[model samples]
Target: MSRRVLIKTLPLHSNYGGILQAYALQRVVRDLGCLPVTDTSKPLPLQRRLRRRLWDVRRGIRMSLPARFDWRWRSAREATASQRAFIARHITGGSFVERAYTRRGRALLARRFRTFVVGSDQVWRASYADLPAQFLDVVDDLDGDRPRRMSFAASFGVDDIAEYRDGDRARVAELIRKFDAVSVREAAGVRICRDEFGVHAEQHVDPTMLLPADHYRQLAARAGVAPAPATGRLLVYRLDANDHLERTERELAERLGVPSLELLPTGGPSPSYREYAQNRSAYDLPSIEQWLACFASADFVATDSFHGCVFSILFNRPFVVYANASRGASRFDTLLGIFGLEHHLTSASSTAVDERVFAPDWASVNRVLDAERSRALAYLTANL
Candidate 1:
């Protein structure tokens, strides 16, 4: 019999990084014959004061426009530029997105599944306005029966946890110890869990990369992305740099006058809303593969996000990771170091301006990926 595992995530607001990770996990879990169930939290009617706070988080903290209505409902309005760029490069046409959360909705999810597995992304991050803490407790949900629980490669970045207190950490330790297994994507996460939660975490690839880079190539081919460009001078967004990164690239484009394209991840301001539901998260917007053709045709890469860095490595494309001094240097730094490709990396201040592809070890990266995949599979199988 298949184990019914409800996959939980922070409210999906249209993030390719998060969507790709979740989709890849669901896909692999299914391939492994593990039930990959979708269970979105139901939205609740916010009091006037509470609504304002949530809106601030959705827009202020993370720069996302929280829809006035439910976020679980998928819609077709165009996305912001960063989201569009993400769509053009990694995800395909929008499908399987969500836009609303309600108490009734949460009830449906609880009724639909038994066990729950959370994260391959920042679902645990405080970035989300209504965290899954709504669904979790120091030991269990404050009132509801607990689902069988585990966290697969989840992260809160390099930040410390503020929610656990009043012996809550110990209570969470109870929850952590109850898990059949746990895994994390970054070394920092490994350290954090061990140091704070008393759970020795195992390292695992983001589920998206577990499938192999060639799989993405095949996906592109299947989706009709013709071929890699012939002249080959693709400037991927590896820099953790911000608008300045764009400005620098613009200058480079002017000087080189060669064909170039940029893959921007979703983040930033939202359109004016007629109401709360007027805007939606990028993850709720569309799939990156819809525009994967753009990246498939790229000659090289640059990016700041961890998965952005991973995809570049997966494609064996020479890429530079812009150290974002803004976000306390992404966890990307730690993961890249783990792979021994540390030399290919540079921080935002590095003089490595618009660096080109250097010799990289695809064989070595894949070897590491394979082992990580096995470790992840082992955790899942043993738990089931």
Candidate 2:
């Protein structure tokens, strides 16, 4: 029988990078000769769900006030609908454990899987750190037959552990010590694991980097993404859209002489919940597969998203990165440094788009990527 692994991370929702990373992580696990399953269970209780709805309704009413009315909220809701449709169509190979938070649910999960893997995103951030389920605490407590616990490319989502509250830091440290093996996505994460927790953690590339570019190309094709433009097109994917980024993209498009396209439904945790709730639009949001196709089809890509930068490199497209300081800049810095493309990094304040032109030495970058891949694979094989 194949060993079964239950991989848990952020829920699959509107976030493109989060969903794609979850998919990529499963693919990598399966490549290692194990069955990887995502926990798609909606663990929130009915009361919590009701309370959430009431909160959203209340917020929506407030936002609808004549003085506060904004149209972006409508766009957000429409984008969310499109995102859900995309996930339903493209995401597969997963099993759901209903009511996974209950005693029976917990027992069912323990009975069904032998290994639990947590990570590939900011699962270790302070917001989720206190949650026992995120830490696989129930699995750890399984009597005499606990499954192996490991983390792959888990990130703290910040440059320092000090960013977490004192109580949260201590709790996170305690939970992390229970893992059989731990690998983080950033050098800063490694430092935190060592300096704060006294646990040494190896840094690995994001799971999205484990697969080849062609793999994503095929996914795009499956999603029915149209062929790339005959000449070349400038693709802009900015997670945090601002006037500065907008100005930069327009300038780049003018210089390159290619039609530019912007991926919509773009916003992050920084936006108010009420704003996102009220946003509704008919603009079709691309599925994760379609999103990959966007990158694959691009002649040049520009963005402030870490995955945007990663996909640009994976597709070998010339690209520029605007630092997303709010989301965490270390992720971009660390990944870019690995490929020796730190020169591509720029700030929103800078007007020039590094006009010298991008010509990455793929041969050297791939060599470094290969070594990192081996390290990541070794960690999984040894721990699992």
Candidate 3:
């Protein structure tokens, strides 16, 4: 029997980490001949899903596709029927809420899903958090049959689980207990799952980094964005309203004396990453292949995203990630620590360093990651 994974993905919101996580899971599932189904549920309700779907359709109509593009063709179509069902649920009204619970039709559809995966992002966050929708705490209901319970790479955005009051912690632990195996994307998350939620979780690199950078380069080459010329250009990707991002980038650009491609971004954590594609110039958001090619092309990279930093390291693109006053830095710290990448981050007020300064014998990182990936694959495959 094929195992059906009901995946809860963070809304695409154009973050590369979210995209990488979903695709990585799909790739691993494909290797196993098991279907991976996605359900992009944030903390929104049915009405919001309805509103968002309408908005997405309007955006879909206004947006032009890449030349030789066909929306109907999908790498996921070859997935199992269960996978298709999950996608349908995920794509529903652009909200997983409407797909699974907001509507009678979708609720009926979700009832048939046997195995569920709670995460690859911040799925445990409550409604008060900024996520678009919340998981319905159905782990208990789903656990009744003792179904194959697992969590892929759940992340809690903040480290202080103590901030929650009014029994939220109880709900969180209750929900976490239903899982048979657990893993998290960050060090704080590993701590939270063990200390707060009472689940033992191993730490792993983001799935996007699991595959080599060359693989993404091939994808980019297929998509047709030529490698960036060696023009000493800096690619700047920042979405947060960090007070000093512009000043730092400007300072860095002037110091490097290279024109920078600033990615002007817009969008929340939603189901479509088109927000990234939309806010960013078409030049910035290339196809996966082209994105990799550009990674190859960059003389240096500057950004504050985890996956952005990951690709930079994968290509050995010299770079630095300026820190933001946000809570998600634990994942950044964990991954960087794993690779001994301590020099890549600095506080916003610090003097800007040339991004070309990265130098580490990634030889150690490569060996550790390769071994971990192999063990993770063995674990996932054996349980299935």
The most accurate candidate by lDDT is 2
Worst 10 residues of 1 by lDDT: 91-100
Winner on lDDT between 1 and 2 is 2
Candidate 1 per-residue lDDT, tens place, 1-384, comes to 876666666544456666677667777777778667644443344575477667757655433545434232312234534454543454222211121234454555555555767676765545452343422432242226765777777765655666445465555666667666677667777776788878888767677776766666676676555556423655655434466455555545555565565454344434334422443452233345543444545565556667767777666666666556444354666668767777666544555453333557778877876777787888877664
Clashes of each: 43, 8, 12
**Candidate RMSDs in order:** 7.6, 5.5, 7.7
lDDT of 2 by residue, 329-377 (tens): 8998899989889878878568587754457787888898889888888
What pairs collide in candidate 2?
73-278, 73-279, 74-278, 74-279, 74-280, 75-279, 75-280, 77-279
Off by over 4 Å in 2: 40-78, 89-100, 128-132, 229-231, 265-282, 349-351, 355-357
Worst 10 residues of 3 by lDDT: 71-80
lDDT for every model?
0.57, 0.76, 0.60
lDDT, residue 361, model 1: 77
In the range 1-384, model 3's lDDT, one tens digit per residue, is 666656666665444556666766766766687766666645446588789889879767644554224322321222123333333333322334334443453554355556656566655545324322333354333322555667666677667565565577776677667667787777888888788767888766666666766776765655455666433678776757675666767777787788886543232332134433344332233334444555577777778777678788787777778665364666677777877777777666577564426455667767877776786676667655
